[model samples]
Target: MQDTGSTVPRRQLGRYLLDWRTRAGLTLVTAAELLDISHSSLHRLEHGQTGRIKIGQVEAACELYGVPEELAAAFTGLARQSNGKSWWHEFGDLIPRDFDVYVGLESAAVGIATFQPELIPGLFQTGDYVRALNRAAFPNASEELQDAWVQLKLRRQHRVTRKHRPASVSAVIGEAALRRINGSPKVMAVQLRKLADMSTLPNVELRVLPFRAGFPTGLWVGPCVILDFGITPAGSPVEPPVVFIEGSTVGNLYLEKPHDVERYHRTYDRIRQRSLDAVSSRNLLRQVAKEYLA
Candidate 1:
């Protein structure tokens, strides 16, 4: 059960170090030499892979990279926050570093754009839907463990309904997601109804991509969540929108490069364009839910 808290701050810290080094035209070897540290250590520092960072090393980097006092102090601030603990640390072993980072970032995101091809999004999943999914997916696991997972899923939904400025959510779901029979028809019916209900919230938008639109090329990898953290604070200027790809065989992945973020944004726009409007999507959900109920 190892929880390294949110990786965002540390990753941000690493990113600044890298940016300053690049701006100063200092290579890994050059920066490491200036700081009297190994090139590998400098590389790791830039990637936020180190669990413990010596402040003296960072100070040396600030001097060599010619980082401004303000930016340097901000970097140090991120360094400290990166080491903060996770509130969900009780489920530490159950979470992967990448997924944990996504959760941490999601908690702080101002808005999220989600795309799903074959199943309900976690934020909107019902307890029964979650339990059934776990039961079918993890047949060997004890029911108690699966129940704990269901509770975890439920807790994650608080972000959408919290009183203190909930994240604005827009989900473009493929028709397959509506049609996929996860649990019993009853369970799915309940799930779809819940989705329609949630869609009415001012902060949530829902759409469905019918089969008529056809899937786009290079967009079928898997479901993804694109998170936007709003304006960059004075302290953190390099914080960019992130694209989180769900892994089929492993855990989640983060794509933060400009190109990666742009690619996902384009994909999201294209998919959204092809999907039914919010009202139409809600009608479709209700229609299908009636079929299940009937």
Candidate 2:
């Protein structure tokens, strides 16, 4: 997983600049004037929409905001990192625009909380499961694009599978997801075993929302992945926690607003309370796998 969200560095760098501007109590217009840049340009930079960012621009903005020396250093470093290349560029037209953002965040996140209501979440899905799902969803896609899509997903799994500094992922899967199998019976059987195996990894915690638990009132009724970055040196979040709402028609929606993040967090907590614990969840998965094997 590449740290560059959306195949560029601007998003995270822009976020840092936006934070600095807010901390300096400067509105977009005022900040633009202070930086001697156009208001639109400044806004784009803050939102990470710029494809080309000069290192000096980031440095100047950080200095103007009177950020501490170390924090300014952090900003400059991010600018450099964001400017670098990654594997996402190779896929070209195969990837979705907004989805790139989700991948980038997934790469950088230190803690992840995901709730899957229908199917296995992408990160945990096996290659065969992915092939089946992609084939069904994009029936007209080119062979090259299909292969690229699977590669993209497998690459993204690095967040959880990376041997060193693996991100802590707490996945709450609905029993319906486990039952409504993807791929063939054999493929699904393997996937179930994969889940049972992955759940035992130290950094991955798996729970199951059984059919018996039903649904909660506030649950927005879709799969969502919440990404949380660890704290920075100054005891603030390096990046604010983000909630990714899976979308089919509208692309992926990333919710960074405090309210949206809070709502999802609460819903996840409530649903988690109703779900089976890790041991029981794994047992259920293995039991389900037995049915398929039998």
Candidate 3:
């Protein structure tokens, strides 16, 4: 009995091709020879490990494996999915692999709610702010790598600015974050002024949790993003909202469990309720910026 349990989609696609090849009495080397591709390449195809799978390669692999058109189509779809550029790919090796998944998720998310305590969120940071941050965060990063990371951060910020596909963003920052000077006073002033200007965007809702707001539960958790993947409606596939918590090294914790998602949603609501309104928040941010400017 061919065990099909625990087969991931990519692995299943690979197995489908492999079974076809075996039934056709073709060895891996023989199949590779017939396809005019390398044995190692064929092995990777069989294992579904090809990230940049060429159309010709999928077609050749299917043909050599005697795969049916429909089955071949499925594998081709998988190959295309594998070949799709993940958002983090823009950062190259500068971004750690664990953090890469969050970038990918952020790219696809339609709405975002964030509660940040220590620093500005990535999607809202200016290039100067991001440059300063990247330098501090990755002290060992090369200048070129820092530049690349900053560029990637700027591109991510465009999600809230793009005319057609803007993400609906709501950010609640702690008062301390606004008061803290990230870079030089001049640079910090520029970044804060940008934040003040951004508060007016129709799609953006910026709120600040003032020191007088008393303590809040959300404050204890550090920074987190609650991403809402718009509703699918009845009879459609439902992608539940997810909560992303950044980890220390590079990767982040993706919370998709219903209970965990609900917890963050509730937490965001509590923080929002406890925070100052948009107008007040903008004024507070400006006030802090003024202090830094002086």
Candidate 4:
């Protein structure tokens, strides 16, 4: 998958290379002539438009610019980061690259908040529900891809179960999620039971947004996820908070903008207000499960 998000490092590397070439008194055309590459090809490489960088080309550029060993190594690291096969590639090409970034971030998140309007969140999905959902979402996906998706979904369980700083999760699910039948009655029964079990985990908080709430904050926005990473004091690595919004075919990541983060935080709080308390939400899920038995 090609990562549309998290391109900051890529851009940084591009600027670094461009600056070096300029300091070496080489114009884009001259650099292209010297490297025996087209002007546009050199431009794209310098601008980070090229998704992958050739080690030889990078080394040649470094030599031309007399780049310090340390800086050259750093640039090489950035290129390597962008060149590796996507983590989701194991699921075949069905999962797009944008989603691969989300998977990477989700694995590193120390806390998460999600608003799911129609279906159970992926992290809590049962194997059968996961299989059914993936098939519906990707009708053309191969059986191997579907199986890989299921495996990945189940692997998310470890994030919330690990002993060292388990991820703290708070989810607001629509009541419709519980009322709708995703698969067979047995499948749903087991799914609901799994939800109940997950809810009891110390790090997980579940709330249901009942229809009667009447959109308290007008936060009828589609489902979204907010992930927060553990922050350290000054001198430590800086990992910023990020919000992810998904559409029909792509996903967007909002970071590096304080206003965007603040807006989402307010929106999340408003949505939470419309949701039932944890106890009530669990009761509602239980009632819905009983209805499935009838």
**Each prediction's RMSD to truth:** 11.9, 11.3, 10.7, 11.1
Compute the lDDT of residue 46 as modeled in candidate 4: 77
TM-score of each: 0.68, 0.69, 0.67, 0.67
Rate residue 51 of model 2 by lDDT: 68
lDDT of candidate 4? 0.75
User: The CA-based lDDT of model 2 is what?
Assistant: 0.79
In model 4, which regions exceed 4 Å deviation?
1-99, 234-237
CA lDDT, every model vs. true structure: 0.79, 0.79, 0.73, 0.75
Expressed as tens digits, the lDDT of each residue in 1-294 for candidate 2 is: 433433234676676688789999999998888888899999888876776677888888998899877667656655664565532322333333423445656777899999998889888989889999999988999999889989998888877888999999999998988899787888889999999999999999999999888786543468889999889899997767878876666555567667978988988999899899999999999999989889
RMSD of 4: 11.1
- Superposed by TM-score, candidate 3 places the C-alpha of residue 259 at a distance from the truth, in angstroms, of 1.3
lDDT of 3 by residue, 58-103 (tens): 7777877677766576566655545543211223333234234456
> Global CA lDDT of candidate 1, please?
0.79
Q: What TM-score does candidate 1 get on C-alpha atoms?
A: 0.68
**Which clashing pairs does model 4 show?**
none
TM-score of 4: 0.67
User: What's the lDDT for residue 285 in model 3?
Assistant: 75
